[model samples]
Target: MISITNLSYYLGSRALYENASLHIKPNQKIGLIGLNGTGKSTLLRIINGEYQADGGTISKAGDVTLGFLNQDLLSYQTDDSILSVAMQAFARQNELQRQIDELLHEMETNYRDELVDKLGKVQEEFDALDGYTVQARAEEILEGLGFSTDDLQRPLRTFSGGWRMRVMLAKLLLQKPSLLMLDEPTNHLDLPSIQWVEKYIQTYEGAVIVVSHDREFLDNVIDVTVEVAGAKLNYYPGNYSFYLEEKALRNEIQKGAYENQQAKIRQTERFIERFKAKATKAKQAQSRVKQLARMELVDAVIDETARVNFKFQFSTQPGRHILHLDDITKAYGPKRILTRADIRLERGDKVALIGANGRGKSTLLRIISGSEPVNEGKRQLGHNVSFSFYAQHQLESLSVEDTLLDELKHANPTKSEGELRGVLGCFLFSNDEVFKKIKVLSGGEKSRVALAKVLLSQANFLLLDEPTNHLDMQSVNILIQALEQYEGTYVVVSHDRYFVSQIANKIWYIEDEQIKEYPGTYDEYEWWMEERKEQEGNSKSVDRKPAPAPQPATTTPRASDDERKEWQRTLKKLTQQAEESETKISQLEERKKRLEAELADPATYGDSKLMQAKNDEYHRVKAEISQLQDEWENAMLEAEEWEKKLA
Candidate 1:
């Protein structure tokens, strides 16, 4: 556990925190939420001892281990493979194992007394720490984070930045420190991998502190929320949903108190002015003045809302067919990302592309937008289809020296200077901010400027990749609203489930070197996924044969009730068998329903192989159901015969 008391920090002339106090409990999942520039990352650094607080007392319980994921650190080199990098977390254990091996080798050669004693102590220490399973644990963590068995042996340098982040995450998970701190940990993760991380954190026994813009991830993983505002920190018990409700109630109370105090101040001033003109009321006026001076003034809380807003204006409607891709095959050397792929997009379609990291979601997007070439495919754009592309790496392409206003103006040459400034103002850049160089802008500011420029292009079809990365919750919601209202085509690749659910009308899922489409919201997609998992579990369970029925003894019954007793026994056995058969049949039927729904998803329509596989599964289950029914009928017939004998 860690406690921060009366902590104060400053960044240049701005006060980041003033006397902020917070207590982090053991095994608590905490979410740090606040507007940009409110010191969320700075606070994390202070906890990790990377940054020293100007004035504060930080206390930690004895010998607590801490691991902090630094987003900006590129210390991991290319020469190291993913497996080796993850295994580095167990360096101490590995060293102990090596020492024990050496000691054993020495004993076999000469049976040295000193070497034997050293090995005993080393073995004791290793056993106490469960050091024997270190390699297995590391591999488990790596695979859970979506690293393929083949990828584990590949050098880290060959991986992209996003893949490198996964390696870092795997190391942290394997280290199993007492406290874990992550800033935007989900940024580099795809949906499936993100789900895997969520499940891992839920089962983690240590405390977790994450600063992220991902609403759904926080909601699923965290139990408490901490908001940094007014140069102080406030804690909210429960998840993000609970925090939102609590914040609203607190804001209402603060607003009422602020208004009441202002009213009282105005009343006192008016009474003093009226009485000061008359000598007889001079004493009364003086008393009133003292009363005003004694009154406690309430300082108004600063507004913490993000002012950036994006609005798209449509110029004209596109043709029926928006885009068409035929036999698209792209690869890098031996690794084929997309192979023999075909897709067609119609106007007014809102689609979400999803897949594991490095599965060509972005590559496919680039090929459609004409930003990247396809190895063997034809990309055709329908008549009157105007497109605006928002690349995930757009930040790198921006000029740091260009002013925000100048950038917007350059993108839209026909727009007047006044029009450009107005657009920037809507995105929270005003007055001196518009004149500031883009190079000096924060990540969030840069994102807003990029989006602003994209909006001005007047393109009907938009392709956005991770558009919500640097945006706060408020800004994200605004963007979602704008995208929902736009009367055009949209193909977005994002990990934010809530945002995708809100705006997308269809989903494109890439798996096993193929792309599939689903026509529905994210909620529907989730339901279908759960059903598929249930069906798989049922199939595995049903592979074994049913247990044999217990046989009745052939010995004669007691003379007083021989016939009745025999009949009763036979009926009981038959009834029990029928009941068991019915239960199994019901379970299989439920599983079959789920499998049918999964097969119905639009994304699966294009894959003939998967469709055939699903169909075959359906038939297999149907045959099983028929067999179960026949068994049930036979059991019922046996029960009827026993009942007649008893009668």
Candidate 2:
């Protein structure tokens, strides 16, 4: 367990945290969330002892270990094999193993009783630590993170930066420290790798604090959320979804209190002004003035909901056929990236391109955008189909000397100053913030600014590469909403499952030098994945089964046309029942909400009649809701069976 008390940190004149206090319980999984530059990573660094806090204390239990995986720490060259680097996590255990080996050799020749005893002690320590299984564990983690069997032997230098980051993640996961601190752990992961990491974290015994922009990942993996905002920390009891609702309620309460205090202050000032010179009311006026002096004015916190809205409007509509890639073949020297790939994009199509790191997802995006040429194949862009491309390494393309506002203006030369400012404000940059130099901005800020510039380009077809990399949950959500409403076509390469779930209408999975399309929402894709796994398990079990005795084949059950029609009718009835039960559940939820609101009123707090009535209503609604849910589930199962039989 770790405890932070009265913590305060500052960078020059900017305060990151002031009197921040947080307590992390043992084995608790926490999600750290905040706006850009709110010190989520800095706080992690302070906890890891890599950076010292300006004030206050951080206390940890005896011999507590901490592991941190940040973007800056993963700047390793690719020349090192991924497995070799992952195995470094067991350095301490390896050292102990070496000591054990030396003692064994010494005892084997000398046969001294004292030497043999020391050797036994060393071997026992090694066995207790599971040192022998270190290599196997390391390999398993690396493979789960998307490194192929052949990739284990490939030098790290041959891998891309994203793949190198995956290697670093594998190393950290294998380390298994008492406390794991991960910032954007899902950034470099593909869907499958992300799923693997989620399963691993769920089963991990140690505590975890992850800072991620992916809302679904946090909701699935973390039990608590620690929100950093306005130079303070707020803790929520449940996951990100619960945190969002709780924070909204807290903000509503704060705003109400602030308004009430302001009203009181205004009333006191008016009373003093009106009665200042009146002889009969002079005492009252003076008393009002004193009261005003004694009153501690409430400082209104900025409302996050009031942030600028981003709505991209483009006058020109793209051609019905946006892009066509025919027999595209790409290679880097001897290694082929894509082989005989054919893809078509139509107007208003929102597609997500997903694959493991170094699988050429970005390469395909570039090929379609015409930024890179295919080694073999023809790519055609539809007439009047203007495209805006956002690269993962877009920072290198930006001018460091330009201010954020200037960059936007340069990108949209036709836009007026007001229009440019409005666009920047949508991305959370406003007023003086727009004047900050691009070089001075944080990575997340630069990402936002880059995205704002792209949105302002007025392109009907957008190609984005890892656009959510450095964004926080709030910014990502805003982007998702904007993209959802945009009429333009989108081809994005992202590892953020939540973002993909929100915006992507189709998923193009790239694997083994090919792309496969899954036409559905993310939930459908997940269901298909689970079904495939179950099928594979069943197949394996069948393979292990003994041979069956030969017997005469019996007639298979064949329903007549009338029987099949009756089965279909039953299936329809079951489906209707399921839907009706779900509707009842929704109605109960609405009643429960109303009952809770009434129970929260102060007038009903101590009234025995009101309390009993509200409690009864609450229990009744809950019981109905539970019963409806059960009925819905059973109805669904019956409907599924009926449908299968009909099929």
Candidate 3:
């Protein structure tokens, strides 16, 4: 548990937070949200102790631990293997294993009763610590984050920046600290991996605070929402959808109060002005002035910021057939990523390319764009198919020396200065911001500039790979709207379901070296997938094969009274077992916490004999606790099965 009181932070002259206070309770999942410059990441850094708050007090429970996903992979030790780095999270488990080894050796030579007891205790401690499964858990986390088994043995330096960040994420998840703080965690993940993380965080035993621009991800993972705006923090008691509704309600109420207060002020001022000159009414006018000054004005609701309003401008249309690919096969050495894929794109078509990470989604896009060559395929472009390709890596390709205005101009030399400036303004680069060089811009700013250049190109076809990577929700919405209106043929690779649903008219799903096409909206595709999953669940065998063909019914039969009573008795026993197991688990958890705290105390390490006895008892209790947890889980599962049968 952590508490923040009167937290204040400043970036130069801009006040980010002023007297912002928030309390994070155990098992609370909070979504930290705001606009680009509102300091959500800074707040996370302050909480993680990487940055100091200008004025605030942050208090935490004495035994609480923190885990933060490191965004900067450059600081990692690249010389080490990926698995080795992830295994570092299990420092305590490794230490206990070492102690167990020493105790075992001591017992072999001098087999005293106390030494044998100590060895047994140490082995139990090792098991309780999950020392045996540390490597397997690390592998599971890594695989879930999109790392292959071979990649685990590879040196960290061999991975690119994005993959390295995944490794860091794996390390943090393995740490399983008391509090986990993540900023834009889904930014680097694909759709499947993002869903995996959502499930993981939902079930995580500790508190979580996440900052992300992915609205769908936030809606899935967070139970509490915190908005950072107007130099204050506002709390909402539900997920992002609930927060939006509640925020709108509050804004409406605030608008009404503000309007009433302004009306009262105007009335008071008018009365004072009209009566101030008259001698008879001078005293009344002075009282009115005092009343006006004493009134507590209500704060106005914050208005939505100006959004980018540019659309793709095309001078010429492409041929009816924009692009075509036949028998496309791609592979990296021995591993085949894609095989015999055929696709076609027509003019004015908008397609969404989707798949898990490293499943050839981006590769297929690149091949279609003519940026990557296929191993065995032919790519054909239609006549007059002028196009612009925007890769995620291309965001960093803008010349650092070029200003925002110059970048747009370079994208289209024919455009006059006025036209270029107008386009820049549409992307929220107004006045002096247009003069700022690209090198000094933040990642989001650079991304906006890149998008502006792509718009200026006015190509009839567009190939976009992760265009919403650094974009905020509003920007993504604007881009989606623009793409929807454009008459160009486009294929976009995106993980943002909302954006895809708005812009894509068709879906291209890549899975297991094959490309599947669905002629429907993203929402429709989602519904179809859910329906298929439900059908599968219905057909799935539950611990047994199908029954053999039924014999001719001699007579209609039902359960006897005795059989019904026995079934009811069994159900009741299962329910009772579930309740009792839950109670015991809670009590044992409390006792385990107390014992852990005592063992963590520095004074406990001073006396070897006393420490040994306490540790032996601690390990015994922990082993029992593990067994009890297993039984508790089984009991709950059995109870649910019985309830389902009764239903």
Candidate 4:
């Protein structure tokens, strides 16, 4: 519905995009991805008209509307309830409602035929928009995004940045814009909320362009991947996983082509150099130089993948047991987070703490790190154990005035500046980037710096809460590699399933205010959970009471002659209805097949009117087919019931 052609945008003098063109088609699910500094979010802003492109054109159909959900919305707050905020999406409907109310008041004060007519028109329009159910729609979306029913009436200002972001997301989803552009939406959502959004986006009628670092979420929701690289938008026909494979193959081919081109250039240059001074071959050498000048150079493939190579070390090795908690009871005001909960951690344990939001995952992390106080219980640390806790709030704790180099030094005074720079380099802060002040760093940059500090702390045990929050896919991979190589015990809370799956061997979740463990990988845990759900479903569906034995029928009275004839007539009519319904269904199915073929034709795409007509008719035909099928089934069912009665 929207076309971005020859789009060029700049940051200072550096070109973020040059001649980058991307066509967003109707109902297309697109994953916009790249490294941290790439302009994924900027592209969205350009499309939403918040930022102007330096050059080129962005065209949208008159019918297309846009809704954008970005991190900047985290600062949006009001005393109004969240439901009220989300319901604001229905501007037209709300106006119509107001008009209806005014007209009704005017009728009570001074009745007029014109007033009645206007009221009727406004009410009709409101009903046409399904205005009455807008509140329910808002609530459904808010709850789907992890808000409770009671929380809907809570003021938006009461929520944290992440929760407020969810409110904005709910508002956008409620708007149902023709093209939805989301920037790192999954960063603010929990696992359940993420999955809910995935399902919703899969069925959404509009086009979607999502910028996210969550690999699993991208794969689940998007059908296309667009990579921003080399000042160009590269399109992939499939999801993130497919993009990875395809990019690898393309890189290999590019590398080969580049090498061949370089060799050819070297050979041509050598021939020119050797023959240029000779009288007989001078003309030929000049011609060769012209040919070299005309030759198109194949650009070399640059591998930008960041790697973590630093080993995690501690001054003292802890005993087998790292941490233990017993009968822990914790509460915030009247809301009890954990009651009589107990958990244990051993050395070398890699645990992924996960669950829906407000389930005490972070609270439990704080408790384990001894940062949170418990109402009743005992927490003990093993011998020689040292720990570092990394949380989102820690990003704020960073010294904004210090350079990245200085920050790492503060984390560990013993580590030299060179050693700290090496650590920062592994986190993708290299060369002059280490000299950048912490205040100038982006969210992902700040996160990397904080993580580097955690690493420099040389702690034997780590409590990491949502460490992947601001990280891009590559940064997350770096953290994964670091954790994979570490021998320390750590419990990390994350909603990014792919990140958790790669690094965690054990799954931990809070249930009934108690910490529960699944001693397996993430995939295994998922499979087991699905199986458990199925088992529970089957148990609920199981017939609790043994079915009574079939009783034999004994009939003494025969139907009267009139009654018998009436019964026969009813059965015959039912049979005829069934046959007629079947015929209609067959005809509709045939019609549906023809429409599908026409819609699939390439020529249809060339004509917008024809394409729209076919699409509308396609849905109409499908709905008709479904209705006819249902009627046919009902007819057959009635015929069967009649037969049973006669028997």
Candidate of highest TM-score: 4
In candidate 4, clashing pairs total: 0
Over 1-647, each residue of candidate 2 has an lDDT whose tens digit, in order, gives 89999999999999999999999888899999988778998999999998889999999999688888888855788566778888889887888888987887776778888887887887788888898898889888888888888889889888777788888888888888999999888877887798899999999999999998888899999999999987888889999899889988887888889999999889888989999999999999999988888988766867665534666766354445678788889999998988998778877889988767677888888888888987898997854478899986887788999988789888878788888888777787778888889999877888888888888888999999989988876678768867877788989998887788889888887767877788887778879878999999989888576778889889878999999999998998998997787677667777887888889888887798989989998998888777776677678668868877876
Question: Candidate 1 on 516-560: residue-level lDDT in tens?
Answer: 888888889889989999999998988778879989879755445
Model 2, C-alpha of 114: deviation from truth (Å): 6.2
Query: After aligning candidate 4 to the native by TM-score, how far in Å is the CA of 511 from where it should be?
Result: 1.2
lDDT of each residue in 464-582, candidate 4, tens digit only: 99999889888888888889888899999999999999989999999888889999999999999999999999999987888799899987697788887787789999878867766
TM-score of candidate 3 relative to the true fold: 0.78
- Candidate with more favorable, higher lDDT: 2 or 4: 4
lDDT values, one for every candidate: 0.84, 0.84, 0.84, 0.90
Which residue pairs come into collision in candidate 4? none
Whole-structure CA lDDT of model 1? 0.84
Q: How many clashing residue pairs are found in candidate 3?
A: 0
RMSD to the true structure for each prediction, in A, is 19.4, 17.4, 27.9, 26.2
